[model samples]
Target: MQPRKDNAGFSIIELMISLAVLVIIAGMATANWQGTIERHQARQTKQELRTLFQVARHTAINRRQMTTFCPLDAANACTNDWDQPISVFIDPGSLKVLAQPDYLIRTFKAMPNGTLIASHSGPQERRYFQFNPDGTVHGTIGNLTWCPDSLMAERGVHVIVNFGGRIRWGKDRSGDGVVEKASGQPISCA
Candidate 1:
C-alpha cells in the first residue's frame, strides 16, 4: 500500500504570499488615515476660531458695550502670543489691557501641539480683538491663519474677519474639496 500524503491546509509559499499582501494593505490604509486626520483637525480648529469671533461680536452687540478678545497673561492682561489661553471679556470701560477675573467672560484653552495661530496684524494689533457696539471690529481688519503641523499637504485653514467684523472660513480652495489656507498657496511651515 502506498503511503497517503494528505494535501490539506496552506503551503509555506501560500502563507508567505498572504502575509506580504496583508502588510501592503495595512501600510496603504495607514497612509490614507493620516491625511484624513490632518484635514479634520485643521477644519475643526478653524471652526473654533470662527465661533469665538462670533461670540465676541454678539457679546458686544447684546451687551451694547465693547468686547475684547486676546491672549491672557499671568496678570490676566493681553499678550502677543496666541498659544496661551484666550480671553473674551467686556472692555471694562477702559482701553488698557484686560484686568483679572472680574471682567473675564470666557477663556479658551491653548491649542493642540504643532498647531500655530498667526494674525495679520503685528504684535500690538494681535494682542487684542476689539468688537465695537455695532458688531464690527475696531481699527484694522485682519485675518488669523490657523496653520497645522506640516505644510507639506493642505492641512491648514484661515479665519478671515472682514473689516465689518464678518468672520468667514477659507475652505476647499479651487474646489479641490480639501480644507486649506487660501492665500493662493499652502502657507509655509515653521
Candidate 2:
C-alpha cells in the first residue's frame, strides 16, 4: 500500500503567520481601548466641573449669599492650581478662604495624575470665582479646560461660564478632533 499523506495539521509557517495576524489585531484593539478611556475621563471631568459650578450658583441664590468655587491648598486657601481638590463654600466675607469646614457645601477630589485642569480668566490667573446672591458671576467670565496628558490631546474638553453664570461646553464646530473655545480657537494642551 502507498504511504498515506499527513494533512491533518497546519504547517509551522502557517501557524506563525496566524499568530502574527492575531498580534497585530490585539495591538490595534489595545490602542483603540486606551483612546476610548481617555475620552471618557475627559468628558467625566468636564461634567464634574459643570455640576460644581451649577451647585455654587444655585446655592448662592437659594441662600441669598455668595458661594465660592475654587481649589484649596493645604492651608484651605484658594490657589491657582486647578489640579488640587476643589471645594464649594459659602463665603459671606468673599475672602476666598475656607474659613470653616462647616461652610463647605461640596468637595471634589483631585483629578487623575495624567489629567490637567487649567483656568483661563484673562491675563491674571484667577484662583477662584464666586457666584453672587443673584446667581451671577461675581467678576469676569472664564473657562476651564480639561486635558489628558497623552498623545490623544484631541479628547480634551472645556467648561465655559459666561457673565450670567450660565455654563456651556466648548465644541469642535470645524469637525476637528480638538475642542474650541467661545472664540472658535482650538484648545491646546501642554
Point to the candidate with the largest lDDT: 2
Tens digits of per-residue lDDT, candidate 2, 1-190, equal 9999889998999999999999999999998988888878886787787788889999999999989989998899988998888899999999999899899999988766355455656775678989999999997788888778783558887878888999899988889778888888988776
lDDT of each: 0.73, 0.84
Compute the lDDT for candidate 1. Answer: 0.73
RMSD of 1: 3.2
Off by over 4 Å in 1: 7-16, 93-96, 123-125, 150-153, 172-186
lDDT of 2 at 72: 94
Instruction: For candidate 2, give the lDDT.
Output: 0.84
- C-alpha positional error of residue 138 in candidate 1 after TM-score superposition, expressed in Å: 1.3
Please provide, for model 1 over 1-190, each residue's C-alpha lDDT reduced to its tens digit, 9 standing for 90 to 100: 9999999899999999999999999999997987787778876777678778988899888888788988877766777788777788989564636755576778887665445566656545377788888998887776666656665435666676777889877666566544455365545445
lDDT of 2 at 71: 92
**Number of backbone-clashing residue pairs for each candidate, in the order shown:** 0, 0
In candidate 1, how many clashes are counted? 0
Per-model TM-score on C-alpha atoms? 0.78, 0.89
